[model samples]
Structure formats: C-alpha cells, structure tokens
Target: MAAVRDSSFERQAPEADAEELARRHLVQPWPYAGSIGSEARGLIGSGDGIYVTDGEGRRLIDGPAGMWCVNAGHRREELAGVMYEQAMRLSYNTPWYTMNEPSAVLAERIAAHAPGDLSHVFFTTGGSSAVESALRFMQFYNNVRGWPEKKLLLSRGGAYHGSTYLSASLNGRPRDRDWMDVADGLVVKLSSPDPFRRPEGMTVEAFADQLVDEFAETVARIGADKIGAFVGEPVQASGGVIVPPPGYLPRIREICRDNDILYVSDEVVTGFGRLGEIFASQDVFGIDPDIITFAKGVTSGYFPLGGMLVSERLLADLRRSNHPDAMYAHGLTYTSHPVGCAVALANLDLLEGGILDHARAVAPYFQERLKTLEELPLVGEVRGVGLMACVECVADRESNDPLKLDYEVGKRIDAHCHSLGLLVRPLIHMCVMSPPLIISRSQIDDMVAILREGISRTMDDLATEGVWQG
Candidate 1:
C-alpha cells in the first residue's frame, strides 16, 4: 500500500503564483533603488541535509549554508522537535521583568565555552541586535566610568558588523556607505588586512607590520582617550573571506588592552564551530577580547537568536562604579525567548556530538580542494579559513585587477551553478562557499566540481561575448 497524504493540510498556491505575489508585495534586503520594492528572488521549496530543492524541483547544494548559518544542516529533527516542545510548554514571556530557565542554562553553557574572563551573556534577537547591544554597552560602560569623551569606534576596511544604525556605522566596505547614511562622526576607518590585496612586492609579514603600525599610528594621532572600541570579524566573511595575516589579531588585541579600548570581536560568522572551535578569539587567534558578539551559527539557523559575552572584568568594574542607580537602558522584547533558547540548546548538543570535530577533520581538505581552483585562468585567488572560502575572479591575474573584470561575473557564475545544481552566494566579483558543517567529502567534491564547471562556462560566455579573453 502507498503512503497516504494528509488531507487536512491547507492547499498551497503554485510556485509561479507565489513568486508573483512576492514580487508584488515583498521588499528584499540589499535591494537597489530602482528595484527596491519590486524584486522576486528564486523560491526555495524545501531543504534536507546540505541540499535545498528549488522551485522547479532542482536539488542544489547549499553552498553559502543559509548565509553562513545552518551548521548542523537542514531538516534537523532534534532542533525542530525542541522548538515545538518549548513553544508548547512556554511560548512567550516578557524578559523585561521575568526570567526563563533555558536562557539561564544556555548562558551558563556559552560562558563555559567562552574565553578568558568572559562570564556573562546578553541575548538578542539576531546578529545586528547583538552588535548593537555590544556597542551600546561599550558607551554605557564608558559613561559610568566618567569617560564620556571616549566614544569613537575603530573599524577596518572589509569589516561587516550589522545593520543597526550604530553598528552599521562601523561597516567599512566600499559599497556599504555609498548611498546610505551612517553616524560618520562616530567611526574611524583603517586598512583591510587582506594579504592578497597587499601592495605589490610586499611580503605578508611586512604587510602585517604595516597594518599594525597603521593602527598604532592612528591611535597615537587620534588619542586613545577619545576611542571607545574596535570591532572586527575574526575572518572578514562578506568582504570575501579575508583571513588576516599571522599575529595581526593578537597584536591588535594587545594595542587595545594597552590603550584601554574595548576590543569587540564580531564573531557573527566565525563563532559556533565555523572555525572548528566554540570561539576562535582565544583558542585560534591567541587573544582575549573585552567583548565577543555572536550570531548566525549559534542555533544553526534553526531560530533567530544572537548574543554577546562580556568580560567579567568589565562587569566587575561596572559593579564597583560610583553610580549604582545608572541603568544600561538596552534590551529587546525577545531578549530571552524560551523557544529560541531551547532550539539553540538542542543545536549546541548536535555540534558537540561530532559535527565540530568533523569540520576540523575536513577543513584541510576543503581548503586544499578550493585552492586548486587558482589554476583556472579566470580565477585570481581562493582564500579562506576552515570551511569558509572565496573564489575571486579577475581579468588580469598578473596585476590581480578584479575591477577590470565584469562586475557581474559572480552573478553569471552563480546563474550557471544554479542550473548545474548548486546555489552560490555571489559577492560582486567573488563567490563565497560555506557549505554546512555536516557536509561529507563526497558532497564537497560534488560542490567543487559543479563550481569548477560553472566558472569555466562563465569564462566561455565572457570570451564569446568579447568581455574578456581567456
């Protein structure tokens, strides 16, 4: 006998109709001014493991892993079950006056895994809020300490913190601030630590020295007394997976410590086993930050949850401050949502069960396989740490001029890959690949194979159209 379909389920509209409805009503993120309110992205029907079925029933590998989350993969029964159970037991609770058990338990677990004296957690709704909270806390801490003038934030080029007003002001990508407005007076920019983009003939070590020198010089020129915090991602994710030079992060941490500036590690993409560790600041980079902001992978994208771990030293200082009545005046309605925390706890169990170790075991292979793509003429460089990598296409490899290449190269490659059964996250002239941590070796091979062919086809198309010669 065949399995029976549930008749009680509500009927759904056709895929094309759904897409049309979205085009008429939805306003997607990162939209252009011309198409801001009328854009319909490709519709995804469902997902299982590292694969998602598209609207037309094509099974494509989730290369970007749902915006660098979904560490445990898709259709996770454990995560889904816990969300249902928690919602049924206690769906919603006001965190302003009350408390929840799961949030407390999750905080304790996270603190145990955190580095240094980071023993406190402040939960938020997502990554942007987590970053916003950290920055606000920095300001509040300074104010309570009677250093109101120390309000400037230091951010490097290629950095991406969040979308909130204060946090978005710290973004340094060229296009991020072109047409948008931010609190410009609050931020000071620094050079990006991209080794591949270093000055011609500069050694990676020398480039590292220049970056550190620039930071020290900037602090000296601007005076550390006026600076509040320096926020950075462990690995620049959206800026094309720019893994900084050796000793770069630790040296920066030391400078922050010496100057009394808060070092905010925006581990929104690197935390929760993206780099084969619970947190990469201390374990991988040998630095203890004043605060660590995290999101994306915390709950494996099973739910919207993000937070930060503040150092015990900072809290102790705040407690010992003269103003005992001053409030932080920061929080969200879903500060400690029980259902989200429950899903996070279950996701944590899944990671510790073996997925993290699996990522560690296969990271070397992942990097090595991706590096092979550099042999392609259109490929300029492929760089990343752990499971995250970027494939940068360039028109002239000798000069490494990505600007000379067609800006739509990444999108073209993505379109071809989508047809060949792989979804890619195109970032201008680069394509980012960060498959689920649970992806197998065979799946990695399949992903790389499809990417290789897609890129080759893109090259062929460009050549035929007289865009660029191979």
Candidate 2:
C-alpha cells in the first residue's frame, strides 16, 4: 500500500475485535452493529456533559445519548453518590409484596412530574420491561373492558420500542423483525407520521391523513372491534429520529379514539429533556398517550431503571379486577430496585433544577448547529429536537436516496470522527445524535466540526472504490 494520490484511507483493523466478538458470541445488535456501526469499538467508560472515555483511553463526545437513553449525561457524581448511600442502606426490596422508601419516593416523583392521568407508576429494570408491561396492560384492559377480541396492536413504521419479543413486535423496524417472527399475534405495522418522508406534493396534514388512513385500513382488516392499542414514539427516535409532522399526533390520537384503541407512547428515548420537553407526546405533539414507556433519563442512566405511566381508568380497572390477587404474571426480580430508584430520585432532582430549562432555552441553538450539516456533501437530512438530532447520509442530493454504503461507509466516517475526538452513533444509514443536555456551544461546534470532516472524506473514499455516483 504505497501512497495513493488524493485517496483518503480508512483503517479496518480497529473494529476487527468487535466483529470477532460479534461473530463468536452475540447474535443480535440492531442499529449498533452489522454493516452500520460495528466498526467503532465498544467502550467501558464515560464522563459528565459531553464525552466517553473508553477503557483504552479513547475519548469521544457521545452525541447519540447512550443509545438515546442518557439525557443527563454520564459520570454525574450526584447520581453516583446517592446510589452509594442507598446501596449502604436498603439496596434491595421486592416491589411485589413489599415496598421500600426510595421506591415509594421515586414513584411519587414520577406520578407528580408525569403528565395527564399518568399518576400510577410501575417500575421495571429497563425500557424493555416497561414496554412489555404496556402490552400486557393492553390485553388486560381489553379483557377488563369485556372485549378480549381487541388484541391487535398497531405501531409506527420505524419506531424502536425495545428488543424483547413483545416490545420488538410492538416496534416498527425491519431489522428487528429479521429473525423473530410475529408469533405474538395481532402486531400490525402502520405508516408513520413522518414529515420528511411525506409523499410528493403532500402537505403534513395530507400526509398525516394518509397515515391515519393506513391505521384505519389495518384496523379494518383486523376489525376495529378487535384492535387493542396503537404504540409509537413522538419523534420516532430509532427510526432515524423522524419527527412527526404537525397535527399528525392529534390525528393519530383521533384515530385511536375513533376506534377505541389505547394509545401508548414509547417515550423511552424522548422522555426527559432530550426533546426540551418533559414528554414529547404532550409538550411537542400536544397529545397524551394512555400509557408511556420510560427509561434511561429517569435514572440518568446511573442505574438501570424504566417504568410505565398508567392512567386513572386503567389503574382503577386493574384494582377493581383484583389483578394483583389474580397475578397478572409480570415483573422483573429487580423491579423497583431500591438503588435504581434512589438514583432516579436524585437524578430527577438534578434534572428538575434550572439545568433542564437551560437545555430547553438553548435547544434552538443546538438545532441550528445540527442544521449546519446540510452544507456538507454526503449529508442530506438533519432532523432534531432539543438536544437530539440526526443526519441522514445520501449519495446524491437530488433524490435523497441512501448511498447503500451500509456498514463500510458508515464505519469509515464514524472512525474518522473518532480519530478527531468526536463520537457519533450511526443508526442504519443515518447518523443519530443525542448529546447530554449539559453540552455547551463549544462542544456542539467541536462535534459538528469532526462530523463535517468525516462526511467530506466519505465521498472521496467511496469515489476511490467507484461505488458512489452523482
């Protein structure tokens, strides 16, 4: 490999360790591995505000918010110190038959802070359990309503709820369903309410109308009387952070109401200040879901914790049904784990302070920086809200079609950024971003600078391979 004129090179050996591990041990790692993001090595450490230090002393700004879960950033001493205190005193207690102080306190905080009739909180170890609990509640609600036939659930076209069987099926992703068949029955996919992907000459209103029509068709096919629930993210994070068009959420709310389906918001990623709102569903979209799944920011990712917000009607039905006595048959061993709850409470206190408001205030500035990516060569679309953002890479600007570089091109760009000390997470063909809410203007510029360099070189590198065309 002598010097090739004007040819930018990308090192492949760096991610070989990750590939080997995947080939030898793991089976599924969606939006993280495979041809998309496997080249970057996995890390074991992080810091406050805007950086993650790998075990090997590699540092990069985590723009994707720790799988879009960590809104409060990592390595916050408050979250850590509180957890230590809790671990010293009453670290574990069963939420099932027994309760703990921290868990009760955290539940009160969640209920008070949560929107709408979401006054009841059921803690889970993580987002997966929260989503699973939401699904179970759908069936239970239908049974309680005396309509067991309404078992079908509808989800958005590309939302990522979780990875467990029920949650995966509830999600709207092709990659997630590649191996697992829909054995769970009645999980229907509907067109998402994305403004960017709207059909030609269609207004956001019309596109949303089409989306509602698709849901109506699904319900018709399944019979509205048989539909149980409709679940989706307010911003559709895992699906390239496709922010739904204006009036889209209200329309979906209408559709759910028209058909009498429970509306579930998978806010596992958009909850907290990620969207500059407490919950994207209510603050951004102006619609409140019957139930919402939450994790990541709830505990600031200090300890694994996710929970489901329940409405009054649902809670009353459950209480009236004697569901606890009947054993609804759901819960994790670490459900309402005391340490996680304590950290969550501490994290909540930290988030509730003016820091969240500061993040919200500067959201427009962060969004402006993200939009600057449009001037780059390979970058096509920049979608974001609050601190969350995404840049969809494309080979040609005219059609907005993907380069189909798959893993190779994405890894090269990501590695190039890493080498420059900026960390970015590539999801599918799009680069996702969710830097900690505490990120400053300078760090945002730093992150964007590296990304610009990486994207600029990707075109040059791909051209050398004769794969990219105008």
Candidate 3:
C-alpha cells in the first residue's frame, strides 16, 4: 500500500451529484431509511488533528471526535505507520485457536491501566461486540454456577448498551427501542440518574438517595437471584451525557455487591482519555466493576478494537467451581486482529505520553465555557464532565419543556454550525461535543464560538419560521 498526501478531496462532479451518489450507495447508520437522500450531510474526505475536510473542499473542526472515538485526533502518522507495519507482517489470524503478539501486548497494556483485579481481557471488533460478549459471559457464568435463574439484566432508563440483540435489549433509550423488538422480560430498568432531570424541587443529594433506594427496592421486588448483571454507563452518553449525582455510582456498586449481581461498566464512550483517564469507573467514580466493556478510543478511530475486562475474583470463582470444564464459547472472527491491536498500542502511547494530562488540565475550561450557553433562552441545560458535553435546547427553560418533536431543532443547529466551520453531533434536540483529547484551549474557544453563533442563528430561524411563539 502507498500513502496519499493529498488533503482536499478531488471533486468527481457537482456537489449535488456527489450527494446523490452517497444516498444511492451508502446506508447510513441509525437513519430513517426513507430520508436517505433528502438532506445533505457532507462527506468527510480527510482529517488532520481536530479538523476534517469535507467532500466539497471545506475544512471544519471535528466536534464529536469522529463519533467519540478519535481521541488522539486524525491522520496520526504514528498510528498509520503501526497499522501498515502490522498489516504487512500479519494482517489476519484466527483467534479461535491461535494468538498473536500484538493482541497479547495490547491486552497487557490495557490491563495495566485498568482498575482493581481486572486482570483478564477479551477483545472484540467494536463497542457493540464488546458489550454483547460481556452479557454472554455473565450468562455463562451464572449457568455454570447452577443459577440459571440469574438471567435477567438490570439497566437504567436512558442507558445505551449496544445495538446487538441481547445488548440492545438492555438499551433503555425510548426511541432506540420504540420501533424494534427486544428480548422481552430479559431486562428490568431503573430510573435514569440524571440530576438535571430529577423530580422538580428535589435536591441533588435527595435525588441520589432516591435513585439508590429505587435500586434496592427493585432488587427486593425482583429478587436478586433473578438478576445476572447491572449494566450502566458511568455517564450516560447517547442518552445525552447525563451525569449522575456524586454518590450514585458507588452506592449502586455496593447494592450490586450485596445482592451478588455483577456490576458492569459500559465505557464505550468514556474510556481511553475521554474522561481524562484510561478508565474512569474506579479512578474518578470510586468503584471497581466486576466487568468493564470498552471501545471507540482504544485505537483512537484508527482501527476497530474493543474489549471486556474481567475481574480476577470472578475468574477465580469460575475456576474453583464445579464448572472448571465449562466453556464460554464466545468470540468474533476479528477478535484480537493484529492490525487493530498494533494501532491501539500506538494510540495508547500517545494518550499515556501527555494527552491525558492535557485533557485533565483543559476539561474545566471547556465545561465552564459551555455553561455560559444556559443564559440563552433556547438552551435548557449544559451538563458534562471531561471532554464530553451536551447542550440541550428547550422551548421553556423554567419548566425544561422541549420544543415540538417535528421542529428538528438539533438538525438546524448542526447545519448552522457546519456553515460556520464546525461539525457537531446532533441528538434530536441536543448538541453533543467530545472533541479530540489533543484539542487546544484556543481551538476550544473557536469551537464554542461557532456553537454559540449557531445556536443564536437557530433561535432566529425558529422565531422567523414561527416555530417559537415567544
């Protein structure tokens, strides 16, 4: 393979024709299939640092870090070089019966950064697979231990585990499951631990106590023997970066431990420096989960790699039990691919070198700057920690009443931001931003300036178009 140094994408034809070609060939993810060609979402041609060049030769700041995975930024020669070398040496290998050096090395490095006794690793192709594998492993563990009744999962409302069947069943996002059929009765959901969305007039501390008490009551009602695992994101990402009350995670961990339920942390969006650490469950949140599913930033979007970290105590129990002969019987064809692992290793070097520290030092500034948006009448709340944040738009801030569903407010904000040379990830009525961990303070200012202007323009549009009566 040869390297292409060209930055701008060469136009094959007019922009309209190019977009039409995309709609014809590409089936966008999480999309309304009927509206494939109705809108023009620019094609990303090339990326460098925190910027991506669109198909029409326009450069824009990457606000969501390529779906919250590109933590080390784009076009990193070191990662590219590692991938090229590993592919040339050993592009493919069957992990079913054989193991590779890169995978072993990467797993060791990951375990080193992981918390507590999470000493074992199982790699997957991406976040979804990682989550699927963890759930399967939990089921297998229960089955082997003669507790087949422990098959139900306990996840919170507004959590997103993955898109696979079992994992998707654990997803609590209303829209995500509205049209799809999930494995019924497999999961019992608790209320989301969103402080911003707490019952009106309830204090944050009281809200946290209520959330924990709810979990305790749910366990008592369902019987802990019927539950296999309690899965949750430290900070719910796709459900809109909902940060919980301070003591929420630790209290949940205690309850799970008391009830003999596996506590699984879904770090698909928060791992690998997104939260200024390799893993945030223990270091930042003060609890050691029995299982941790991670993806996205492992290779910094240079390669597809995700994994599940297993605690030593759980494996010890499995080894000592009568199920010593039991087999987990789970893996993927691309599990531990050498190229992905090699790229991940290089990405880790970048993170551990200095980027993690930079993120920690700059996160407060980022949060502080975005909080100013709350002054805008169209903005309801600003909530986040570390590099990730969400700005939710509302029609009434006093009541947090959202705009009408058909208003497409988030899309309008995204469009305006794109015009101003910034790319933001829109989740219905909210804008999500998790820029590259390498982004500078000055770059953050530019990104926030564009976001503010975009929101302002959106407010004007909504008023002019009669979408906002006030």
Candidate 4:
C-alpha cells in the first residue's frame, strides 16, 4: 500500500482563477440563483477509498459519502471497468421495442433480493424517476382494477420523495414546496414520526400508536376507495435523517393493505448496504411493500440508474383484469440502459462480496461514537441508525429551541469539519453523517474526532457573537 507516483494521471495544480469560469457557467441546486461562484464548494479533483481530495489537494474523509450514494466508496475500478466494457460492446438500445442482456439480468438479480412476490422491475434514470414510475404504476394498477377513483397519494410530513413534478408534489417538506406549485389535490399530508418533536408528555410507544390511529382515522374520513397509494421513506433521509420508532413501518403496511392501497417504500437513500442490508424494508423492518423504489447505490454512484420492484401478484391481476391489451405507456429513453445495468451488476458483486458484512459489523460502533457528541452544550440531540446519523444544534438545550435560520449552525460546523479533514452534510441547523459503508473503525474514530472539534469551534464562534449562552 505504499504511495507511488503515477505519470499517467498527474495532477494539474489548480489555479485560483477557476472560480471565474464556474461562476459564469455552473448552475447549482438549492442555492441563491446568483451566488454559485462565491458560495459553491471548490472543485473536487479526485477520490480514493473513503476520501476525496479537492482542487487545493485537501484530502478529506467523505462523511456524507458523496450525497449518500457511494456505499462502496469512491474510485471503484470494477464499476468503472464495467461501464467502459458495456459502452464498448453496446451502449444504448431503445427499450421500447428492443431489449438488452444486462438490463434483464440486473432486473432478475434485483427481484431476487426484494421482499415477498416483488418479482418484476421497471427501470428509470434515477431516484426521481423511480418514484414517479412507482406512482404512475399505482394509478395504472387501480385504473385497470376498475378503481379509477383511487387517485389520492398519501405522504408524511418531512419526507423527501423527489424533484419531478409528481414526485415533488408528494414531498411533504415545507421548504421543498414553499415556492413551487405542487399538485394541490393529488396529495394528503400526515405528521412526521419524529420522537424528538412529538407532543409533550407522550411516550415513544404511545406516539407510535397515535400515528397509526391517525392514519386509520384519515383513511376512514377520506374513504378507502379514493386512496391510490401511500408512499414513505423508511428512514426519511433528507429530512434530517429522521428514524421512526420500531413497529411503525409494519403498522403502516397493514393499514395500506386493509385499505386496498399500494404501499410504496422509497429506498433511494437507504438501500444497497447503507443500512447493513441489500434493501431494508424486509430484512430490517419486516414489511413487504407492493412497490419499492431504489437508486443511488445500485451502482455506487458510478452510474445514473434506478428502478421499482413490482409485486408479481399485482402485475398478474393487472394482466388478467379489464383492459388486458392496454399499455402502461410510460418509459424513458434511458430505460434499462445497458451501460448502467452492467455497472450495477458489478456493483452488486462488491456489496455481496464483503462490503455489506463490513457495514453491519461497523454500524454499532459508528452510532455509539456519534452519540457521544450529545454531551456538547450546542448539540441538543444525536440520533441515527446504521451508518447514517444527525446532530441537531439548539440554543436552549433543555427546551430544544432551535436557532434562527440566519445562524446557519450546520454550515458553520461543516466549514470547520472541511478544514479539519472531513465533509459532513449540512441541513440548516443539523449536520448529517452517512460515511461510505467501507469506512474502517480507525477512520471512523478520526471522523468523529474531527466532528467534535468542528462543533467545539462553532460553539466558540457562537459564544463570541453572544447568540448562545453555554
């Protein structure tokens, strides 16, 4: 493992002038329209293992795992090679009338790992398309079943579904929909299962029961025949990594079944070894979703690909029911792209080889290490499962009073962590960590120590500004 100089891929020392070109060209997501040049993170040059080096050659531990998709880590030569080989042989074949080998094989492999009778797959370009396809399939299934009135989609508050119009409408996060025009009557919102934000004097178990009751009551009020599907993220990743209580998912599944509603599990951020499993719905939560949407880690971020696993029973009913010759009539140009599927197949080999087991073994240690940060005065709560975690900062520790929006506590912590050799996800006042699943125990220790120091620095800054009394 000794470092060796390589002439083939020599680094071009980054010039400070690069910012000028970026400012005039690049359009970043979720930022002030005109601030990309001044506010964007500097150019990332390269990555290896669990670390990424920026243009200035600052090698930092990738705590957010490249937006929680690089489960196997960066610079995976096997995945890269697969994409290259597939491109060389056959890159694109319109999936409308024609088909490809890699696509069929990848679908079979995915169905084998999915829960229950989920034996079919519908490919998409990414997480947003996966979600959009699942919703459309639900509508199609109900329409073919003579329940065309069932068009309502139920979603929970604080859920992050996707960016497409239909999928984005299902997103219940306030900030996600504040300025955008969401499909008004298409979605019904429910409260999030955030224990930290639960009503006062309510026990966790009671809160769980209350949530299920509310769901049942809502179904009764809205009439089951009018509901199409209920979509949810098992862990609510982008909503500050909010983990629901035990038994919550199963209960929701039961309610969906009773009401003849399709249960859609959005596993875009939780699948493919991130939660110590191939897919968390069945293995970890003990529930079988009618349709499970997945993306991101399918190819470990090496390719753009995602899809939905459909239950055989549902497809069978649709095939046998009315409108038997009707077409679902929905597909993307890149549907079942040969190159993406080939890369995904190779990525699966790495996960099954040993990376999944490594993640399972190291998860407990990761969770325990993060919990220690709760002792800091600025940290109000530290919660997570597996490799994903969140540290919420507040001004009043006892009452959990969150800081003002302008404070940008999480961004401050992220800035310090970046300087100290780590990069964590910043969500307003909370910092999230979901490191590459292959990160070692020693490297995890380093990550946590840097986060601790980052928070310490932020606390000092806040004290100087007199915004928080520690």
lDDT winner: 1
Residue 254 local lDDT, model 2: 81
Please report the TM-score between candidate 3 and the true structure: 0.96
Badly placed stretches (over 4 Å) of model 3 are 1-18, 36-40, 405-407
- Model 2 weakest 10-residue run by lDDT: 1-10
The residue pairs in collision within model 1 are: none
lDDT at position 202, candidate 1: 98
Error of 3 at 376 (Å): 0.9
Clashes of each: 0, 3, 0, 0
Q: lDDT, candidate 3, residue 434? A: 96
TM-score of 1: 0.98
Q: Report the C-alpha lDDT of model 2 over 116-191, residue by residue, as the tens digit.
A: 8988888998888899999998887777666889888887787888877888887676777776776457677777
Candidate 4 global CA lDDT score: 0.90
Sort the candidates on lDDT, descending order: 1, 3, 4, 2
Lowest-scoring 10 consecutive residues by lDDT in candidate 1? 1-10
Q: Write the per-residue lDDT of candidate 4 for residues 1-470, one digit (tens) a residue.
A: 11222355434534465555556665677776467544545678889999999878999999999988999899877877777778888989999899999999999999999999999999999999999999999888888888889999999998999999999998877889878888869899999988888887889999999899999999999999999999999999999889998899999999999889999999999999999998999998899999999999998999999999999999999889968887798999999999999999999999999999999999999999999999999898999988899998888876787877335899999999999999989998999999999999999999999999999999899888786778
Candidate 2: residue 218 lDDT (0-100)? 74
lDDT of 2 at 238: 78
TM-score of each: 0.98, 0.89, 0.96, 0.96
State each model's CA lDDT, in order: 0.93, 0.78, 0.91, 0.90
lDDT of 1 by residue, 1-470 (tens): 12222354357667998888878998999899999878888999889999999989999999999999989999987888788788878998999899999999999999999999999999998999999999999999999999999999999999898888988899888799898899999999999999999999999999999999999999999999999999999899999999999999999999999999999999999999899998999988888999999989999998999999999999999999999999999999999899999898988998999999999999999999989999899999999989999999999989999946588799999999999999999998999999999988889999999999999999999999897987
Error of 1 at 302 (Å): 0.9
